[model samples]
Target chain A: MKNIVKIEQLELASAVVELGKKVGAGLAAIGLTGAGAGVGIVFAAFILAVGMNPNLRGELFKLAMLGFALSEAVGLLALMMSFLILYS
Target chain B: MKSLFEQFEIDLYCIIITRFFDVSITTITVYLGLLMVIVIGMYKVSLYKATLIGNNNWQHIGEMIYEFVVDLILEQVGKPGILFFPFIMSLFLFVLTLNVMGLIPLSFTVTGQLLVTFTLAITIMIGITIWGFRIHGIKFLNIFVPSGIEPWLLPLLVFIEIMSYVLRPISLAVRLFANMLAGHLLIHIIGVAAIYLMQFYFIGILPWICVIAFMFLELGIAFLQAYVFVLLTLIYIANIINLH
Candidate 1:
């Protein structure tokens, strides 16, 4: 459905490489959508927990943080992969 | 000025020629060395005044941080973790300072570099593994086994546990690296957009507002990520100590 515009400076070989890199990077970025959902769930649960027990907010915040880091780690791994694909 | 991406490059300053080897000094070394100096100097100059209860402004701030970290360790790891107070506190301060310093205009972000974070994570992981073996002996391997698991499913669950355990260091390093890199890159793009839009002179406010909001978010994350790293380190150590 998508097209790569033919540029005068880009030869066939270079174009193929570029196309592959872009595709690979795009695929890697797809992982971010999942990360987005994961982060949303982390904060959502955090808020829900705080709402349930107002006094437990302090303890819950730390748990939320650990959860955030774990979920964000998954997403960041994907982002790093994309970065590596594009830059390297 | 270097291009946005080019700023991440590590330019060599000078090479040290010892009798046995040559060590290349670069921007990373400079920043890390500066970070070390700032962390050590800040704590020493502030806390060394009066050991019991110094009334210096920086001393009060340092004590507040010390109390916060102490509470965190006590809450998470309990009595055994008191011995690691200096290490954990220093780790938190070092990362917090590094992340905050990166927010300064035109300064290179040390944590944004994958190699630096990976080295930190790997060293911690290696140390924890060694410490686990030392304390728990063969019992440390019990960490991979769950108490309620079915006998037939033990192998499968253990494999999953071991795999996740091995991935911890990689995840820890990449999380910090990517977060720092993302914050910097987003700020750069927004900044450029804000500047360019100013030529038109009206809509520039939108990007500037976004830039300001993101800066605040970056500040919170600067603290959050450092705390997360230390907290996780403690939890891992706690697991080793309790073999749970």
Candidate 2:
């Protein structure tokens, strides 16, 4: 079992709120792990497509960029959510 | 320990107008100083002829930037995007200046703030939407309504499209804001660690090396984030106008 530090002098309510903020912030950021995988997959596909057909590089790149932006938006949303959980 | 966010804390200098509008003088001063420098730099670069015939030293850099922006617009949005060359160039240069200035030691990163970047994104988005509407009229609604949708799936598809469209500005603003904030925070944290570890004889070197490497990475990111921001903006404009 992990050792848990307890402050005898401090009240329980405030300590709980403090702990909640940290844990909540982290929980919100869990979505980013999936987002990272999504982005990597998108770029990996992009590289494969470009390698196969040099002539399709320009068109493939635009699609890849669009995919990247959409994927990144998910990560940013998660980040903003975590910030909100921490502050509010 | 000063908290990691302590670096982002803004100290109010002398208020410019205290009664109705409480303006922070330091923020204004920094913005105006950067603006003046960018304006002068643009003027100097544009003054000389961009020709390989005569002395082509000073104007070469300007020509290169101009050509790059032009080519990027043409490549992304086709010939129609060339109409937005001036706006795109100015926007890229302005963001680039703010981003590079933030790298200066002891300088505030205004671009890193959500307020600044969100305002820019929202205003541009509003303008682009209005422009699209003006050009395409009610037909612009077609952007949300994909052709040949199943009767039952219409609502679901339209809802998803509208939601994604609404999230565009938020995505654009957050991307740059988070990147810069992370870079600056990393640099500050490493610097602080280096200072604290300096008490040890040999351990300080590792943190110092990290600090230097991170600074170089941050410097590259400063330029790259600006480019990404502009490129995305161009893409949005093309999508809006072309509706493809």
Using DockQ as the measure, the top candidate is 1
Candidate 2 lDDT over A1-88, as tens digits, reads 5676567635686888889999999999998898899989999999998889989998797678667756765676787788778866
Tell me each candidate's TM-score.
0.90, 0.83
Over B28-107, each residue of candidate 2 has an lDDT whose tens digit, in order, gives 46675777787677657556454335457667667778898998898889988888899999888888888888888888
Residue B219 of model 1: what lDDT? 91
lDDT of each: 0.87, 0.82
lDDT of 1 by residue, B193-236 (tens): 78878888656488788889999988988888998889888888
Error of 1 at B132 (Å): 1.7
Clashes of each: 0, 0
Off by over 4 Å in 2: A1-10, A46-73, B18-24, B42-57
Which ranges of candidate 1 are over 4 A from the true structure?
Answer: A1-10, B17-22, B48-56
Best by lDDT: 1
